[model samples]
Target: MTVPSGIYIRKARIQDVRTIHALLMDCSKQGLLLPRSYNQLYSHLRDFFVLAQDQGAILGCCALSITWDDLAEVRSLAVAPECRGQGWGRRLVEACLSDAITLGIFRIFTLTYQAHFFERLGFQVVSKDNLPQKVWADCLHCPKFPDCDEIAMSIEM
Candidate 1:
């Protein structure tokens, strides 16, 4: 799907971190996804792809963090409230998937509340146990660690 006119997806830049953090935080407060700290965002800045308007406002962001040799986790996906349903979120994810393929990784998984959204993008529900233990290291800090309600989904591209 093409991005909405005036909006485009690109690698996250250092200047975009604060806006990305704010967007993720807004989504987190609505119980949409996990929030990341400035530290985490800065450290993993290279993992992010952001959707921005032509005027340069960030509308959404997502990250593809490599988990194991053949696995990568899609996390921190968020789209502005006004921009939902316009295909911007999917575009952000596609950017990540493109990056993954470029890096020679084929398996992409996500712990998400929007299962149908990912499903439409070719992701399937999977058992959490099927994921590597190392994938949970960050979960240790999640508020829902022991009882995460987010559905685990994967797509082999």
Candidate 2:
């Protein structure tokens, strides 16, 4: 995806945690994604990327978290409601995919309600059981744990 002029995609900075948290909160409230706590954001700040204006207004965020050797997961992808349809979401995920490649991780997956969106980005639906058991560590904390309704999708680079 071609990022439009005046928009910047960069590794998230320390100062971006709050804004990223807020964006994630908004997404979670809408059931688009799960909400992350400040502690979680601070701990995994290095895993994130933000799509922002040249002047520093954040419009979106995404994360590429290494889950295991040669494997990673794309999580917390969100774009401002007003910014939907502008390709920012695609750019955010693409950025994560690029990061995965750079880290030499060829397998990536995401658990999402927006399966169709991820599918457009080359992720294919897969059985949740196909993922490593370690991947369930986080799911134990999820409200949907034993009854997760989110789609599991993956792509191999």
TM-score of each: 0.94, 0.94
Count of backbone clashes, every candidate in sequence: 0, 0
Tens digits of per-residue lDDT, candidate 1, 16-89, equal 99999999999999989878999999999999999888899998999999998899999999999999998888
Angstrom error of the Cα, residue 50, model 1: value is 0.6
lDDT by candidate, in order shown: 0.90, 0.90
Pairs of residues at least 3 apart in sequence or in different chains that clash in candidate 1: none
Window of ten residues with lowest summed lDDT in model 2: 130-139
By summed lDDT, which 10 consecutive residues of candidate 1 come out lowest? 132-141
Query: For model 2, what is the alpha-carbon lDDT of residue 114?
Result: 100
The C-alpha stretches of model 1 lying farther than 4 A from their native spots are 1-3, 134-136
* Per-residue lDDT value at 78 in model 2: 92
RMSD of each: 1.4, 1.4
Error of 2 at 21 (Å): 0.7
Query: Which residue pairs come into collision in candidate 2?
Result: none
